[model samples]
Target: MSTVKVNDATLERINELKEKLKISKTLILEIAVGNYHSKFFKKKEDP
Candidate 1:
């Protein structure tokens, strides 16, 4: 596990989502990172 520091606003949002979705903070971050990677990073086709 890694420790990350987040601003108050971000922490508030994360907590809101966690309560709304009934998921853990770690899963919230994981899903967010996955979405970010999918949106910003393209996968290269294998030759």
Candidate 2:
């Protein structure tokens, strides 16, 4: 179990996207964090 604090603006945006996309907030965060991880943490291959 873990806890994270989100700012007001980001929280509001998440709520808006939740209603518009009709997805759970947990799913939204998961997608976002997964994307962020893939963007930054991907392994590089030597060419």
Candidate 3:
């Protein structure tokens, strides 16, 4: 639906991962975003 701009090297890495991992670019990006969110944004809640 929307777009984000990435550098040439980053795009190339993404393409390489897409082929090697046999996964869609969308999924690759989704996982990357999820990991990033967990690492930097989300806080661990104590039970």
CA displacement after TM-score superposition, residue 8 of candidate 1 (Å)? 33
The most accurate candidate by TM-score is 2
> What residue pairs clash in candidate 3, if any at all?
none
**Per-residue alpha-carbon lDDT of model 1 for 1-47, expressed as tens digits?**
76987899999998898797766766889999999888666654333
Q: What TM-score does candidate 3 get on C-alpha atoms?
A: 0.38
Pick by TM-score: 1 or 2, better one: 2
lDDT-best of 2 and 3 = 3
Model 1 misplaced regions, further than 4 Å: 1-23, 43-47
Q: Candidates' lDDT values, in order?
A: 0.80, 0.80, 0.81
Clashes per candidate (backbone, < 3 Å): 0, 0, 0
Task: Rank all candidate structures by their TM-score, best first, as comma-separated numbers.
Answer: 2, 1, 3
Each candidate's TM vs. the true structure? 0.38, 0.40, 0.38
Q: In angstroms, how far off is 23's CA in candidate 1?
A: 6.7
Q: Compare candidates 1 and 3 on TM-score and give the better one.
A: 1
- lDDT string for model 3 (15-44, tens) is 898797876766889999999888765465
TM-score for candidate 1, residues paired by index: 0.38
